[model samples]
Target: MEKKCINCSQRFNCRDSYISWLFFIIGLIAAIAIRSVTFLMELGDIYAKIAWYLGVGGFFIFFVYKFRINHRRSRFIKANKLMEKVSGRLELKERDYEWIGSLLCSLSAKKERINYFVIFGLSALALVIAIYMDFVR
Candidate 1:
C-alpha cells in the first residue's frame, strides 16, 4: 500500500499535498481576517479613513502576493520531485523551470486581482452600511 509518483511511477511519501492543503487553510484565514478588520473599523476623520483604507488594501495585496508565490513554489518543488522520482531522469533545464515559474506567477497575479476586487466590493458595501447607520437612522 505505497503511493507512486504520477509521472514516473516511483514510490515516495505523498505528504506535499497535505502540506499544501494546510497552507491553503491558513491563507484563507488570513484573507478573512484582513477583510473583517477593514469592514469593522470605523474612521471618523477623512485622513484617517484614507490611511486606513490604503493600509488595509496594501496589506491584503502584499499577503495575497506572498501567499501565491509560496504556494506555487511549494507545488512546483513537489511536482519536480515527483517527476524526478518517476522518470528516473532529472532533465529539468533552467528554461523549463523558469517557464513554469512565470506561468504560475502570472496565474497568481490574476487571482490576486480578483481577490482585490472582491475586497473592494465588500468595503463599498460596508461603507454603505455605515452611512445608513449614521444618517438613515
Candidate 2:
C-alpha cells in the first residue's frame, strides 16, 4: 500500500503503485543486463532475445498505463505544497485540506483536468521531438 497525495480528489494507491514502479525499474535494469551479457557472449539465442524484448515491452506498457494515476498524484502533491505556505492564512485544518481541494475540483473540473492534459501532451511532444532528433539526425 502506498500513501496517496492528500490533495488528490481520487484516492490512489489502494495498491502498491510505487512498488510497481520500483519493480518496473528493476525489471528494466535486469533485462538490459541480461541482454547485454547474452549478446556480448555471442549466444545468438533467438529465444533469449525475444524474451528480453517482451519483458522490456511489457514493463514499458505497464508504465504508460500507470502514468495517468501517477500524474494525478503529482498534481495533488504540487497543489498541496503550494497550499502549505498559505495553509495557515487560510485557516485550513488538516481535515479541511481535502474539503477545500474537492471544492476546487468541483468548481474548476475542466480547467484542472485540461491543465494536466496540456502538461502531459507537451511533455510527450517534447519526448517525440527529442527521439526524432537523436535517431534521425
Candidate 3:
C-alpha cells in the first residue's frame, strides 16, 4: 500500500521500521563476528582482545541507534508534511515543500555525522588501548 505524507498530501514509498530492526540485528551479528575473529587471531593479550571486541561492538551499536533515530524522525516529519499539504489550510507552494524536505533531510544527515564522530571517538580509544597492549607492552 502506498503511504501518504501527512504534511504535503504527497504519496510516496515509506520505509518499514521492521527493515531497520533487521539491519540493527545484522549489525549486532557482524559485531560479534568481528570480536570472534579478534579472539581467534590472538591479535593481542586478553585485555587487548577484550578492548577490540568492545570497540567493534560499541561502534556497531552506536551506528544502529543513530540510524534508527534518524529514520524515525524523517518518517514522522514526512508524514506531518503530507498531512499539512493535503489539508490545504496553509497553501504552500511545491518549492516550499521541497525546501522543507531538503532542510529536514540535511538536519538528519548532520545528526548522523555527530553520532558517527562520537562512536569513532570511543572506538579510537579502545583501539589505542589494544595497540598499546600489543606493542608497548
Candidate 4:
C-alpha cells in the first residue's frame, strides 16, 4: 500500500525571519566598515584595522549564508528532477507543484526587499561621500 504524505503538498515557510534580521544587521556593519575605512584611518591605525576586520568578517559570513542557500536550493532541484518537470519532459504531481510554489515564495520574501533597500541606500551614501571627499573637497 502506498502511503500518502500530509505535509508534502502544503506550503512550507523555509526561511527564518530572525536570520533575515541578523543578515540585515551584518550587511549594515559590512557597508559601514567599507565606507568608513578611509575616514577611520585618519583617526588611528587601530580604528582602520578594526574596520577592515569587521568588513572581512561581515562579508565572509554573508557570502557563506548566500552560498549555502543557493547550494541547498540547487541540490533540491537536482535531486527532485524539478527542472526536467518544468521543461515538460516529465510531469509534476501535486507535491512537486507545491514544492516549486514554496520555492518561489521563499525567493520573493519581503525580508529580501528590505535587505536590498538597505544595500542600495548604503551604496548611494558611499557614492556621495566619495564624491565629496574627492571632487568637492
Candidate 5:
C-alpha cells in the first residue's frame, strides 16, 4: 500500500514482484515446449540428448531461483503494508520502524504446515502426467 516508509526509509514496489512472476510463467512454458520437442526427437542423436539435458536442467534451476525471488518480494510487500498500519499508532524513530518491519516480515514469511496428503496428491498428478506424455505418445 505504502510506497515508502517515512520513518524507516524502506521502499516497496509490486512491479518487481509482478515481473518475476511473469518470467516464471514464461520460463515454465518454454521449458515444457522444449521438453516436448526433445521427447519427439530421436533419442539416438547426440544433439537431441544434449538439448534434453540443457533445456530441462536449465529450466529447473531458473524456476527455483525465480520462485525464491518472488517469495521474498511478496514478503517485502507484506511488510510495507504492515508498516503503513503500525506507523500511525507508534511514535517511533527510523530504526524502530525498520526493526518492527523486519520482525513482522520475518514472522509473516513462514509458511503454514502443509498436509502430507496434498503432497502425495501432487506427486500422483505428476506421475500421471509423465506416464501420459512419455508412453501415450
Candidate 6:
C-alpha cells in the first residue's frame, strides 16, 4: 500500500506495518506484567514471582527494541547530517525537507493507534480491578 508523506507529498509503501504486531505484543506484555504484579502478589507468592519474571523479561525486551530503534535513527540522522545542518542554520534545503519528511513518514505507524487503545483499555481495567481488590473486598 502506498502512503503519502504529509510534508513532501511523496508516495511510498510502508514496509514495517506488518512488523507492528511485534511491537503491540511487546507493549501488551509489558503493560500486563506491570499492572498484574500487585494483583498477582495478593494471590500467592508463586504467582507474584511469575509476574515479576514476566515484568523483568518484558522490560528487557522493550529496552532492547527501543535501543535498536534509537541506534537506527541515530545512524539515519548521521548519514543525513540533519543535526549539523539544523544546528548551524534555520533554513532547511529541499533535500533536507525531503529527508525529514521521509523520516517522519517512516516513524508514523498505523497500528500505534490501536496499540495505544488496547493498552489504555487494559490499564483502565487493571485500575478498576485493583480498586475493587483493595477497597471493595
Best by TM-score: 4
Per-residue accuracy of model 1 over 1-137 as CA lDDT, tens digit each: 86633321121332335544454444444444444443345544554456556555656756675677679777876766745643776677765655455544445443456566766776677577767767886
State residue 24's C-alpha deviation in candidate 3, in Å.
3.1
RMSD of 6: 3.8
Whole-structure CA lDDT of model 4: 0.77
Model 2: which residue pairs collide? Answer: none
| lDDT accuracy of residue 91 in candidate 6 | 80
Per-prediction TM-score: 0.35, 0.35, 0.35, 0.78, 0.34, 0.68
Q: Candidate 2: TM-score?
A: 0.35
Residue range 1-137, candidate 2, lDDT tens digits: 65654444563422434755564455454444433433333455675676566656755765565576568765865666646646547566676666566545444434335545644664466466556655766
**CA deviation > 4 Å runs, candidate 2:** 1-37, 77-91, 96-137
In angstroms, what RMSD does candidate 4 have relative to the true structure?
5.0
Per-residue CA lDDT of model 5 for 1-137, tens digit only, reads: 55643322243421235654555555554455444443446444666566566657756866677578669766865756655657567466676566566555534431211223433554466567668767886
Per residue, candidate 3 scores C-alpha lDDT tens digits across 17-39 of 67545554555544544444433
> How accurate locally, in lDDT, is each candidate?
0.55, 0.53, 0.56, 0.77, 0.53, 0.75
- Maximum-lDDT candidate: 4
Report backbone clashes per prediction. Answer: 1, 0, 13, 0, 0, 0
The local distance difference test score of model 2 is: 0.53
Q: Which of 5 and 6 is the better model by TM-score?
A: 6
* Runs of candidate 1 exceeding 4 Å displacement: 1-108
Q: What's the lDDT for residue 8 in model 4?
A: 27
lDDT of 3: 0.56
The better candidate by lDDT, 3 or 6, is 6
- List candidate 6 stretches off by more than 4 Å: 1-12, 17-20, 86-95
List the lowest-lDDT window of 10 residues for candidate 2. 33-42
